[model samples]
Target: MFSTREQKLLRYLMQTEKEMTGLELAGHLHITSRTIRSMIKNLTAILEEHGAEIIARHRKGYQLHIHDHSAFRSFLKIVAFERVNEQWIPSDPSDRIAFLIKRLLLSEDYIKLEMLADELYVSSSTVKNSLKEVRELLTKYELVVDSRPNYGLKVVGNELKMRFCIAEYVFNSAQKTTELVADPEMAAIRSIILKQTKRAGIQLSDIGLSNLVIHIAIACKRVLLHNYVSMLDEEIKNFEEQAEYLVSRQIVTDIEKSFNVTFPNSEVAYVTLHLLGTKMVSYRKASDALSPVNLVSEEILTLTANLIDQVENELQLGIHDDQELINGLGMHLKPAINRHYYGMNIRNPLLAEIKQKYPLAFDAGVVMSNALHDSLGVHINEDEIGYLALHIEAAMERKRLKPKTKRCVIVCATGVASSQLLYYKLKSAFESHLDIAGTMNLYELRNYPLESLDFIISTIPIYDDLSIPVVEVNTLLGNQDILHIEAYMVDHITLVLDYTDPELMYFQKDLQTREEVFDFFEAELTKLGRIPAGFKEAVIEREKVSPTCYGNLVAIPHPMRPLTKETFWSVLTLKKPIAWGDEMVQYICLLSVQKEYEDEMQKIYQFLVKVIETKALVDQLIKIERYADFEQVIKRMEEYGSR
Candidate 1:
């Protein structure tokens, strides 16, 4: 049997397609390089027993080699089951931080630092460092870790915030487990809540129902801890008049009877708060026929319209008339406002992936949130912004389907069977966005016309220069190959660039913080009379909301709103990487768009994404000291981008 560390190592290796260095693995696992080496040695022996081995190369580090996939899978299952049965004692810093938080959150007594260190089998100093992360996590929930000289530490905060934190972290695990509906108490409460909501003619989506169950469990836990949520009497009186309040009362009455606990007015108010905010019904058709003002409050409707207006005005996403988007935002904003009023943090586990995959939609969401902030005096958090992005992305998709589809041709070196296989694979992967014009063998490519074809997906390497881009891939296409082809199809809108200036493109500037980089760009633009005053303030405000680092050592910093009279991109290449939020960046593109212009900014964004997706281009561009070198790299990038 493998240790927990070894199991985690194996799982990570199996999932990753690229070879990982010892240092990279160490950084991800939060352990020393020495520990990584020892663990791999131990992991190798255990893996060999299951016909798997860890492959090591001089430059590429380690890769997993599995001879019998079924054997390795069986080994993994055994390890996983064993892990579940055993009490998990975390060894990694991040895991220890989570473990420490659960301990402090659930414990009624102060946990001594020495005791924690001893239990985790770490030094007191390591435990202390982990506590710092715990405090940071708590700070987001408006909770705190209080310490005494001898008694050690415990969590302290308002009862509401404490319960919210508990619901977020402690119940987050249970929400994943069958424990949520599988537990007898929770299942009964879920049934009662569903039955009562249905009886009252209130609509609760599957996710909303799950959310309500989690809140109910949290309420039960808090009540058991004698930490009751308190609400103002006047507010409770106002809620008593609403239909949701009545429904909540019935549900709470049933819950109290089932759980054998006394029901308080405050507890009833808590459930009512959820009911009032939860999505009542699908407003897609209603919003289309009648204005959103009829379904939701006039103020929120106006706010939603203004947000959509600003985003469409800037991005020209062609989604302003999307009724579904309008309905989604209008419906979501009502609850979002309620969440803001209560200072609740909505957890988004997909935030990082959302930013990576849907960068354009994410920016639109940020703009929408800023519009909400300016108009309604409502603060929107990143998680809520992510939720908004989903709606915006859906609207974008609807808009996309209206446009002409991109067409591509597939090339296979082998027999007709292989070509047919590759052709079908491409169709399955991109049936909606792409049109598979045809497939051809290597020799038949000579007569094939490339004028109308968007790009080429070739199973074999093509040595000949071609006008259209050709993505080399295996007969059984992989993810990276798909991404390569998709990149071309996506950027097919237009590859034109009118913003790059030799004078504005600075190369290899030694800068550190985000502020320093912004200050330098703002000063240069201001000196050239290219930007107005307070442009930096707008950029800073946007950065404060969410850092613009989009992975791949790239950061595209732009103002919260259009500040320049003309759309242009100002480029900066750092001599070395600097921390831009959580991601390290050496490539910076400062974007300043005009207030009104149907420009090809999306194409320019595609160009930037091209630069981001290719590390060779970024590395070469970063090392450039002259304009010629920078231009040369861009030329090479364009050449590679073209074919």
Candidate 2:
């Protein structure tokens, strides 16, 4: 049987078509290059008989080649079956940290470091290092690892925080909740939650329902262990007055009868807090009597309006007038404030995807987060920011549905008949794609409304520079002229390559940390007089709002707001991957956009999103050392995007 690392290595190789160097594979697996070499040699021997071979290329790296598809499929099936039955062991530092946390949380008594190391099949020192990360993670939940000499270590925190931490670390696993708790018990808890919420007319999202079930199941487990959440007399009194408290009591009573266990009044209040925190409000038009915004308080409405205005000011996305966004965000904020009041951390499973796919909207979410923090004094986590981004992204999508066509005015030096002929030809060629506002002479273009136009399609060469792009075409309007006009139409996505400065590109740099990368950018850009001294400071502030690390070994860092006179990218690729926020990153693209081009920044963000999402593209780009080769990759990306 293949070892866990070998299986992971093979899985990674199989997922991608591109070659992966030993260093790259090692970086991903969190192991030494020497270990990767040894593993590949052994894995090669095993895979050969299974109709697969590991191809080692000269300087390129290794790739997986399957000679017999049927045999490889059979082998994968066997591996899948084995994985289902096999006991999982912690293979990486992240895995070990999670394992240690789960073990410590579940255990009532102190657990020895040596016992943990033995269970994880790792050295005591490894467990100790992992515990440091575990301790850091626990601090977020106000929990700590109480280390007692000779006794070992135990998790120490408030019962409420302990359950929250448990819900996050233990129950929030790749494996289903039923895998951790008994399936029957989880099913019963879920059934009770669904029935009670439905009966109370309390609409809950699928995630909210699952969270309630997990928390109640955890409460049951802890209560059986003689651990109960503590609450002040005043707090319980206030909770009892809420409608959620009555619903919670009914749910808890039914659970008690089914499980043959009793819950204290404080436990019912605990359930009520979750109900209030995770409650969903259906959005409706403000004109409707049943609108959620009608139920929302003035404070929340004002806050939501301010957030929308702030995002619109920063992004110029024109979403401030979106009624659906206004209503949805107002409704989301009501529960969000309650969650903050109760110290609850609602999980957003789509946070990573949201960051990658809807990056512009996510940045808008960041702007909203900063506004909320300033107004409400609540620091919204990435998960909550992701939820906010969803609303903004929906608004963005709605805006996209009625996309603004490329508007152009024809400039003709000839007579009206020739101009009309040219306009008719252009319209016949690109009727759906372009909107010809009107035709005018070059002299009349001086007085025309240039602000409303995307570009000017001129028959004759215009000598003067203008605010909008001017595409000079033949009076006859040939196929090549049509293609040139088309290029201008799609320039936002295709012109991304132009933003990458060859002088700004740094490849295979020996940077050790995020600070080192920042310092390098500061020094280089400063020497070139490309940025102000405050540029790095602004970027750091942006990172503080939310780390720009979008996984896939890529990070696109930028100032919180536009600080440059022109938009451009300063690219940096490290010799080795460095810790970037919660992920590892080697490709850092320092994006600087001009203040006036904030509207066009969305296109740039979309381009960066494509780079972040395409693992193969990032891997290929990071490996490149030459500017010419980098240009080729970017050109390919542009071509692929155009398709």
Candidate 3:
């Protein structure tokens, strides 16, 4: 695995398609030429293993070349595809405006546009103004539209880009967002602190305190994941444990499940217990070699020292561990003082996975790491450290659910207007709990049709011979029409997610391979009822904003809304390969959030990152066919989780 710095350099060379000198690469990656050479040598080995090689042209930097694009493209699927559409594809000032009025263009052909006008009750002309550059955009992609006196306008080519444009154009209303979205986490932390205060019989708000905790947590993850480039025996381990320890004490739960990992496997038990009992530094040496000394984030360590000092003076909360904090940041930040460009090398595997999963985050991490070094006297590899925090946070939100349905299809209007609204409505109705495949519109529902859909509901009535349950609504979205349908789905998904997969939650004693893992998770979801808003269709649409895949043979497919569960959950592992965008992912840990556990959602979120880290464990779980054995594994994990 290449370090983030190496990966960034590799991406730049691939994108630039030109020779970059060592000086330029060092400048871009923000590392010394000597470090650049080490990174290049390592990268060459990784690429060579995959039947590709990096060419070093004298003083010039290096270039990765492969004879085939397919493998490279496949690799891209695991990393590059995560940040595919974070940027807004814009218009050129010189381009011509071309508008197509849906009213004029089609009477029988349906392309719904109500969401765009939803807030404004948009008219055809208003849409035209917004789409002034539509024609120019289509032309740039080498598509042509033949226009005449009789036939006003028509799209003549480039089907993919046009369809993509149309799909994304109306998708803005779906409220799709990049997750670990900060807003919710902040709120959750605040609520927890308030509860803690209430328990302690104190009246303090601790408003900024939650942020401080989160920042410290992020910093600790960063140090463990990002090499400080200083001393060999790093002190980051203690910092990370401190962060987790603080969270555990304040929140009354492990960071992975947030609710407390009750039956943690041996490894989890060890880690959690170590954090509670010992300094994070010692835990690092004992748990994983790279883990210790890596926990100290330069900024967080320094800021933590300062904050503790202030708190000690004002609140009289006695904190004399200032030396530890100083030691943590003092060394980590100094070596990071001179970043060449993209920042230091990508030495951390977790950070590499994160960067591979989210390009924008990787880029932003680079910029932020360098800026923080310059401005705050804090130095660290931003992607490594920054995203390590992301992983920890994500792991906390993880929810392990079982296949709740036999099969089901969520019908919205061609994924627009009523369909779009109805989709999220049903998911919400189910409390965001359901084992769903993909959602579809009433029109092309059969085009990407599944052999089995246990149920279907829509505004329009349709009859089919397939024994598939159908609930017809008057319109796709709103009051009685949509609510009744959603209420039913909630029940179905609840049942499937809880009962069906419960048998498979145990850990298997045997090892799993790539193939056996494939057969599981290709099942269904029926309805239970009263789920959180925005569950299935809404979740699928959220995915439209960005592919849900987090790269590295894993993707956590979920809706934006939270769901309600019945306390117990069933985990369904796929036994067959399912295409997760550009790559194939063997596992997807579905979650069903039971209503009472809202405060502890962070635990499940954090567990997901752990799953990503331990791919081998996931592979082992996927290979088990017997639901009974799966239960054993879950039992093992649950037993060990409490530590």
Top lDDT prediction, candidate number? 2
605-624, model 2: which lDDT tens digit per residue?
A: 87888888887898898889
TM-score leader: 2
For 49-96, candidate 1 gives per-residue lDDT tens digits of 997999999988999998999998898787666566545566655567
What lDDT score is found at residue 385 in candidate 2? 95
Query: What is the alpha-carbon RMSD of candidate 2 to the true structure?
Result: 4.4
Models sorted by TM-score, best on top: 2, 1, 3
Model with the higher lDDT, candidate 2 or 3? 2
The sequence of per-residue lDDT tens digits that candidate 3 reaches over residues 1-643 is 3334566777877876667777456544534567677777777776765656778777655676787677666766655443243222112112112113222121213333443333224464664565555555555445544544534445544332332233222222122332212455445545664565345333221322433333323322323333122211233343334434333354434233442323212222222222232222221322333421454455546654553343233222122353543454333333234222212222333554564444323322333343454556554543335432342223222312333343456665543676566656666656445445555666667664555555666556665554455777654355775556545543321223233354435333221432232222222333334344444654464345444455444555543333546433345454344455544455555454454443223334444555556655565666776766655655565445533
C-alpha TM-score for every candidate: 0.71, 0.85, 0.26
Q: Please give the clash total of every predicted structure, in order.
A: 0, 0, 96
By lDDT: ranked, best first: 2, 1, 3
